[model samples]
Target: MAAKTKKAIVDVKKQFEKIAEQFQTFQILNEEGEVVNEAAMPDLTDDQLKELMRRMVYTRILDQRSISLNRQGRLGFYAPTAGQEASQIASHFALEKEDFVLPGYRDVPQLIWHGLPLYQAFLFSRGHFHGNQFPEDMNALSPQIIIGAQYVQTAGVALGIKKRGEKSVAITYTGDGGASQGDFYEGINFAGAFKAPAIFIVQNNRFAISTPVEKQSAARTIAQKAVAAGIPGIQVDGMDALAVYAAVREARERAVNGEGPTLIETLTFRYGPHTMAGDDPTRYRAKEEENEWEKKDPLVRFRKFLEAKGIWNEEEENKAIEQAKEDIKEAIKKADEYPKQKVTDLMNNMYETMPYNLQEQYEIYTEKESK
Candidate 1:
């Protein structure tokens, strides 16, 4: 047997084992869409709540439409946003139009909220250069497919915002899986060090592409990871749109006020598999778990709240959904109207001055196409 170690006082902050269990998840709506505490809810007019719900419905429909498009061979590699409407869509409503956005792949919904056209989003998914073009007025970058890359890149954008003395912030998002990357910590730490005006959101969807949260992280809570960076960390109910919007709105205020970065960990669930064509969630999570989360559906709860206020009904919902679908259809048609992509576009845009080898490759491709 080894020598026994002496017992000593423990630092509360370092006790990752206890923190996850102790952190109270901030929530505004109950499972049935009733208010848990009316006083605690965010102040929103009845019209505002309806608009919010409309967007959530649009997001869900868009996800379904994108999947259908992919199956029809009209789109390419796509991430399903079915279960994350509240976290990604509602949080976006709190952002200033001028805020710089660097988003992860699943965050196309947010990019749309930031002024990216529906057709452009479709174009990007189809691997077109037009997809990368955002109207210059919209201060955002195209979605990053590389895991955890947006964290550091957004940090750089946030630094620029801070340096320019603008009253804006740079916001970015990642998933629980992305939280595992070293760039996650490095970016947050760098932002914290520089007091960069940034907001880093981690949508902790419980499964990192089939790996349960228990396996993805040993930390009690992902928000606690921010403790190391000397910034405020918050845990919000990602299933509650009101809660998400309130949390992000407050974080934006803090960032614009010259406060450093914030790391927000949303306790959410991704209802679908990792992607439309890849990763089967069935092997990792139980159907019972899915059923349980379905009860907490953000759309249902928010609709109930709106119904209570006499601002929404089933008929209105159907019309909004139909309108959203028609809008998507029109946008897809516009995207298809774009001329077919050329080999020249692929080789010319990669660099300001094409390297020697790339030039030769470009010439070879051009010659072959001509022949």
Candidate 2:
């Protein structure tokens, strides 16, 4: 007879600790603007490198102008994107036009680059219905506001793409806080089980509003959570555009090749409050922490790398900034020219044939407007 075996007690916490140690933080550039991992650098051409830097700079300027507009009551429901340029833009830079983008509320910059016009983005911020309208060729959904909802939706979109025999991927983003939601797990697990082509990115910017990442979960890293779903997970230096681009490009390739989904945790930081709706970062985060993250600013890091290559300079950056300002000015003017949104507008767009109850309400609202 075989020797009787005794059950072994498993140390769950220690196992997780060891598991976390296996996932390293991927980086191509250091905080000092030096290439630390030259081997992992993306194969971007000189022009492409400069273009990445240019988009990051333009996005920074856009963030600044958006904050000003929010303060002046010209914009609504604004989420500041000052410190997430590399994580947002560079990953998007890796995607092709055929890939579908499912964005969170903070991902408007990516949507804009993906073909949504600046005026439409402004309108969306102001809660106008027309903002939902997109160009016929654009393959993106509106920025999701209900936190982790986009994660589940992205899984569906990816499944749809696979069923159609399309060689494209679906990508979505959420914050560190969003990783805590049940939908996040459901989305990744479903995609992994079915081998759906999807990319899930968690922009771990240290906080979910006021709660820090420490309070969110016990897992050592968000990326490691992908293991349970049978997919690869990676943690990338979000401040390094090259690293983000490389990681995303690899993930996209794997996805289209039927390797399923990837979970990317970008180690980045936000330099402002969660939103313009009366939150304060000082109450929760320290000034020293903010300063430390500022040292790793994506724009500064990428600009340094490009300057070293003789591809970017102050003059080029200034031109980009000025162009951003002019474009924002024109978009805001267009938004101002739009007819004021009304209750009737919302009801009219609810469906092709309104129900009896809805039609009655619509007529009542229409009569009130006429008066």
Candidate 3:
């Protein structure tokens, strides 16, 4: 009887593996900008599609400007999301205003879509604490630069929402490399155990800075990691804005319905290096790989889709580009001229009353700086 039970378990595991392999990367748009999966396409109005396209274009322009700013020594460091716009924009768009967002370092597009002022982002890049402050009504957290740290906080937020019986969901963004962190598992496990309304979006951009995905984890897909935590997982083509929107919409629906958390693995790529000041990818990754990804560039493909729908043209494209450039320039100007942060503001906020030691230290630092 024991031998029969063990064999049954092995057979079931093999069957599950076979079934999983059949789930291909979910995609709605083809490389030629055609909607191959028409069933999965959302019913977006012409104006809505055009607006999304404009945001994507703006995101690309922002990335370029950020890199230039870094090179010119205006900004400290920036993570460029050159190739992953669709995944970030689409996922954020699927959320309601009440839903919460926990973003990773490279998710600037998400923050922008969530109504974070561009000037604040610029200020943050310049190392200002005020840039981290979200509007009182905005249900978004500040961008977490420490890789996968946001996952744990997002889970806690979800738990609080569930406890309060609120319909809000928490969406946590992470990269493929972040999936390898222990906190990722811990967060997901807790979310599952508590049935917290959290959705983990992993942007699998093939490479994590210098390391490839294969070296990062042995799992075939980051989505598979959801299985151990007893949650649903889906892999979608991150380049297909419609597909990402659909997947996230479904996950958000499930979360609100108290169906527990879901993990979404967005198969995307980053055209640039890990950060503005990083080495060229041509050294670690082949030029061919970069060229191939360029062929499936999310912005390029989405533009084609919009054109097919008769909502975009060269004139509008050029106009949008110019407008984005002007807007970014103005933001930079404003951020550059903003008043400098007071040194004491940092140590004074967290405590009701300043501890004696910290107060003494703050005074000493201020006195020396004054001299």
Candidate 4:
């Protein structure tokens, strides 16, 4: 009787799995640039759709510009968000100005979407420390280049908000590669224990540098990791701008409502290498794979949706592109004109009272520069 019961349970599980296989990946727009799931559409107006499209296009253009600048030795290393614009912008649009944002290296679009001036990003690219200074009322931290480091900081900010009984939520962005770090689990656990109002946004771009997602985890979905933390997890099509916006909005709503934290896994892909100086992706991934993703490009998909709503046109596209180019150009000029950061500025921020060794070194460096 025990053997029969075990066999029956296994059979039931298999049946349910088969049913699950029929469900589609959460998407508002289909591959052919059509709205496949109207039910999942967010309450976005025509102007909002156009504005979002403009931002997406601007991000793509800026990414390309940054890569060119890096190649020309005008900027330091840069992480390109070429194909992940929709994922970042959509999630950023769902945020409130008072909420805090913790971003990884590839979140330029998110910062820009939240009114981070283009010049500031260029300044950061140019290696100026002050470029990291976000505007007042903008609760955003500087981009974290260290893998998984932002997770704990985000959790800490959220915990502070909870302590103050504030309605603010902290939005933290990380990559699939970052999930491997021990800090990821610790941060999630901390947020869960305290019921912190934090939204952990994981952009699962299928590859972490050269490593594929299959090699990174045995789990079927990154969202499943949230289950262990006792938090709600949801997977959404990261290429679908509206879908991402809706998911983040819902997560933010839950967080602000005292429902606790959420883990959002955005299924997306990166069109470029890990960074401007990184090796070619052709080594690990194939041209065909890149082509497949390009077919479902978020910008193109969203443009189609906008056209369907009668809000997109060639004139508007041209105007937006020209404006973006002018804005980016002006930013580049400003960054170029900004004074180079002095090396001594780094030592000053290291300690309240400079250690004797550091003080001596600072003097030596200053004397050498003066000479």
Which number leads on lDDT? 2
Off by over 4 Å in 1: 1-5, 9-22, 368-371
- 19 in model 3: Cα distance from truth in Å? 5.0
Write the residue-wise lDDT of candidate 4 on 1-371 in tens digits.
46553444457667546544533367778766687788878888887888888888877888888888889888886898978987898898888888899999888667777768888888787767777888886788888988999999988999999999998899999999998888889888899888999999889998888899989987667777887899888888899998899989988898889988998889899998888876788999989999999987998888888888788988988887788788888988888888777767777756788898788889887887676
Give TM-scores for every candidate, taking all chains together and pairing residue i with residue i.
0.94, 0.96, 0.93, 0.92
Q: Candidates ranked by lDDT, best first?
A: 2, 1, 3, 4
Whole-model lDDT values for every prediction: 0.88, 0.94, 0.88, 0.85
lDDT of 3 by residue, 171-200 (tens): 999999899988899999999999999999
Query: What is the C-alpha lDDT profile of model 1 across 184-282, one tens digit per residue?
Result: 999999999999999999999998887888888777789988888999899999998988998888999999998888999888888887888778888
Instruction: Encode model 2's per-residue lDDT on 1-371: one tens digit a residue.
Output: 99989766998878877897878999999876899998888889999988888899899999999999999999999999999999999999999999999999999999999999999999999999998899999999999999999999999999999999899999999999999999999999999999999999999999999999999998889999999999999999999899999999999999999999999999999998999999999999999999999999998888888888888999999999999999999999999999989998888787788888788888988999998
| Candidate 4 ranges beyond 4 A from true positions | 1-24
* Over 4 Å off, model 3: 1-16, 350-352, 368-371
Candidate number with the higher lDDT (2 or 3) = 2
Instruction: Give the backbone clash total of model 1.
Output: 0
Q: Rate residue 129 of model 2 by lDDT.
A: 94
